[model samples]
Target: MKILLSTLAFISLAVLLGLLTGGRLSWLVRNTTALRLAWLAPLALIFQWVFFELPGMDRHDLVFAGHLLTYALILPFIWANRRMPGMPVLAAGLGLNLLVILLNGGMPVDPGLLRAIGRVGVYQDLASRGWSGNAVALTDRTLLPFLGDWLVLPEPFPARGPYSVGDLLIYAGGFWLLAGLTRRPAETEAPLKPA
Candidate 1:
């Protein structure tokens, strides 16, 4: 929930920055018209929400599979929009996140990092739950620990919590994408055709 809120906050900032830079909302809409397979992103989110939020669904493997499937569903959308401004960066972020998640079988959140961020309740929950949603408790056994959720934003800040490097990249790319929409491209690509 915190992660989602943080993402939303970043998105809001992106929109504000865009408007402040004279980027019209209509331009964003027009720019998005070139996006293909965009619905898949939302579908991926729905898939995760359904599986991760299911009551009595404590099976780790199932949740893990659902998490992977969510990525699978999103990959096509990203690929389809690869040419869009800031998309390559977003893809890089997505790739890093997917790589870490694949290696660890889920996103890992370090308890110590959580405590440092003053999210001790989350750390305690992870300790009791073994895994929460798509995040597994970070352990020494965790592969690519550096890529895990250890980056912290302490209190007295909105959207304060642990964030991965990939998360930072994702937010940055999102900001660029939204802000970039202010500038009209030289030429628009044709809509993708059935292959």
Candidate 2:
């Protein structure tokens, strides 16, 4: 939630910057129709919620299996939109995240960082209770720890916990994407002559 909100905030800031520079938001909206496989984004979010965040779900392994499925669904959205600004960066971030998650059994969270942010309890519970979800505690045993949520947001940011490199990439990509789109002129449909 915090990550998504932070991403939104960054994108909003980028759009505002665009406007200040004489860029139009309408262009961004209009050009977004070129975003193929867009529907997969929402579906991916739903899968994330259902498989990772839901309560009372059974079979941790099954839920764990679903994590890969979720990423699989979202990959198409990224691939289809690769030509857009910020997409390649976003793809890299997503790839890093997916690789780390797959390697670590889920997205690895540093327990210490979680404590620093005062949000360790739920993750600890999820880890210890055999509850299925995306997020494995960062440990000496954790593979590719750097790819995990290692970038900590200090004071003033909504989330204090460590966010991933991929998270930063995602934020940057989204901001650049919006800003770039805003800089483009909106296409005006040609007026039809009396045919």
Candidate 3:
């Protein structure tokens, strides 16, 4: 959720910057028309279905399966569109995240990091109930610990959160993808128009 929000925020900043620099906002939409981004729909739809009725889900394993499927699905989409701008960076982020999740059985969010955001109790409650999306109770056995949500954003933001390096790559890729739309190639003088 935070990843999506932060990506959107960056893309919004790109739009604002584009407009300020005499670029038409419409240009971004027009250029993005060529991208086959519908490949990402399942990722969104599965999550929407999960989070909408988050209280009813009793098994983390099922949630984990959905993620596995979604991330696995991204590979073919990326391969087909590898030539597109920003796709490679986006693929790198997705690959890192998928590798971590597969190795850890889920996202291995540290409890202390959750505590910093005042979200530890909520995760604790979920654990008591028999399920949790993350908050893996960080331990010696936890795999790929560095790839988890290890970076902290302390007090004074709209939300207190820990983000992963993969999130940063995704944000950068999304920003460049949109920002590239506003750029127009330099015009050359038309053979010095004879007077």
Best by lDDT: 1
Tens digits of per-residue lDDT for model 1 on 143-169? 999998877675666667577999888
For model 1, the superposed segments whose C-alpha errors exceed 4 Å read: 1-6, 116-121, 187-195
TM-score of each: 0.84, 0.82, 0.76
Which of candidates 1 and 3 is the stronger one according to TM-score?
Answer: 1
- For residue 167, give model 2's deviation from the true position in Å: 1.4
Candidate 3 per-residue lDDT over residues 61-151, each given as its tens digit:
7777766666666666666556545667877887787778788776667675666677766557444642366434555787888887777
lDDT of 3: 0.61
> How large is the C-alpha RMSD of every model relative to the true structure?
3.0, 5.1, 6.9
The C-alpha lDDT values of all candidates are: 0.78, 0.72, 0.61
Per-residue lDDT of model 2, residues 59-152, tens digit only: 6677778888888998988876776777888888888898898887878876666666777665566457623256677878889898987677
Best-to-worst ranking by TM-score: 1, 2, 3
Q: Rate residue 73 of model 2 by lDDT.
A: 95
Model 3, position 36, has a per-residue lDDT of 57
List the lowest-lDDT window of 10 residues for candidate 1. 186-195
Query: In candidate 1, how many clashes are counted?
Result: 0
- RMSD, candidate 1, Å: 3.0
